[model samples]
Target: MLSTLQPLLGLGVILGLAWLASERRRAVSLRLVLAGLALQIGLALLLLKLPFAQAVFLSMTDLVLAVQRATQAGTELVFGFLGGGAAPFETRYPQNSFVLAFQALPLILVMSALSALLFYWRVLPLLVHGFAWLLRRTMGTGGALGLGAAANVFVGMTEAPLLIRPYLAGLSRSALFALMTCGMATVAGTVMVLYAGILSDTVPNAMGHILTASLISAPAALMIAGVLVPEHPDAADRAIVAIPSTSRSSMDAITRGTLDAIPLWLNILAMLIVMVALVSLVNQMLGLLPTVAGEPLTAQRLLGWVMAPVAWLIGIPWSEAQVAGSLMGIKTILNELIAYLELAGTASAELSERSRLIMTYALCGFANLGSLGIMIGGLGAMAPERRDEIVALGLKSILAGTMATLSTGAVVALIL
Candidate 1:
């Protein structure tokens, strides 16, 4: 019974923290909060439990695998043997690092261009609008904020704001918080494929999990954002906003998206190199410290110690809590991509299947320090007047987003 109740306990603890930190405790809506929690619980059950739903969602993994194959074809043609695949004179099993850089990362470019085409075709906007409409009706979020939040499921944090650019200035504090939290709480669809590729073998229904994470995180973010900063009366507008797509034609959309991805692709490569190198250097320096537990104290162990409770709080088994916590810590300090890579590197026998599932949910967001900088820069550019408010709320939004993901983990624990 105690074990069965842990998830409920975890949910209570997370909500308590949000409530304590709320700007106006009296303004938090219990009805909407319960509604959001119900939505998360229902989604988890449908996507992971029901046979038909599971099959439908899990099929996404095959689709992503198909995308990977397509990406491989392009990479093989351009880079030849070094780009992976069964090309002549190349090793059949290439190094993952090489494949990740040359083969997998290129998928981002493909996905971006594809996303633009979808937008140009009006499919993306229609889908985003449906989700946004649901949020507005259920949660009473303003149209602009709901659209932006829902758009994060498909686009990057920076680019999602473009969907509601005209209303950025007029958004209420709570709505703004929800917008930022949603952005930080979920990643773009472009990178989702990349991360899914890394963990495909390790986690069953990997792409399904990624999709569910983003989908469920939308409400979880709004719930947390509402608690942290309640919506103001002036900010509650029922006017629906149109989804804006920036392209003249299908060809133009593809061209623009490919160009847009250039900087993002480069940034990912640079951050991977720089951050990985820096972490290695830091570990090396820490390795110089006196030995503890008969082995040298390293960054991983330290992070594990720092975040172990969080791992446990999110329903990871105590036996595997530290390892799980270390992943969360890495995600918080660095980024989810690095954390997922480390997870993918872990021997299957070391972390139990349940723990791996919990960690996957926990580490699904883009709430690290690196992302905070990106959010500030991107959102700041869109609304220069509110740059200071954006800066002030940056750190808090990260915490809110983290809580949002953790809440998802807790819900997963309850049902899974």
Candidate 2:
């Protein structure tokens, strides 16, 4: 009974927090908020439980796995032992020998190129528009905002706004906030396979869960954005935003996509190196502090204590809440990649199935501090006039995105 009730507790806490932070608290639409929550829960049930949908998602996961294996083959041929090929010299920690830069980062390049081909073929735009139409009809979001929000599921924050560049200058504050918040709440599909590769061993249907998180985050983001920045009655209506599949040719699409992915790849590689070393340095300093519970006080443990209530609110078991909290804190402070790598590294037997599921849902986002700068730069580049607004709302968007993903975990716990 307590288990069943915990998710409700989580739901209440999430809603209460959103309401408290609302710009015009009394004016927020309760009906629309409830509808958004229902949409998230319904999509999860359909994708995870229904026969046809489940099979379709599972097939996609199979395709992703195949792509991963293909990437590994290429990695082995090119880099040898560093890329998980047989090493010439024996090394300590053989598992660590498969460096992320060589094995996982290459997947980003492959996915970006493949996505470009799909876009050039008009397949991706068709899907993005269909999803955007649903958001407009169901949530009353403007066409420009709806399209931008849906596009974020497939592209990065910066790339998505480029799709609706003409409309950005005229978007209402509420709509702009929705666009930014959605960007933080979801990861681009180009990197979904990379994340799935990291969790292949521990999580069943890795691609399926990643896809579901992106889909579920759309409405969840809309709900939070609506509350945080309520639309003005006099706001301008957005023109029909075109979803263009632009490329000179198929070969051009491949080249352009591959080139576009380079910056992202470098960013990920540099961040992992610097952030991990910085964290290690901090932990070393923290180790000098007085012991707690007979264990030296460390950064992860400190985060665990600070974020434990949030973990428990999201239906994590009290016994494992500290571990779960630490993961959440890491995702927020550093980034989702580090958090997921840690989660993937943890002993499977230590965390229950329910706890693992909740953790996956909670950690699936791009809401860290680094992303805030990315969003500002991306959107600010598209609409220079609104640069100040973008910078001002940066922190608020992070909070909304964080709550959006947590709402997903809370809903999953309630239903399953």
TM-score of each: 0.75, 0.75
Candidate 2 per-residue lDDT over residues 356-405, each given as its tens digit: 87788888888877677567655665577998998899889989999999
- lDDT (Cα atoms) of all candidates against the true structure: 0.77, 0.77
Candidate 1: C-alpha RMSD to true structure equals 4.5
In candidate 1, stretches whose alpha carbon ends up further than 4 angstroms from where it belongs are: 51-133, 238-301
lDDT for model 2, please: 0.77
Tens-digit per-residue lDDT, 18-84, candidate 1: 9999999998988779988988888888877665875664465456557667878888898876666
Error in Å for residue 268 of model 1: 9.8
lDDT computed for candidate 1: 0.77
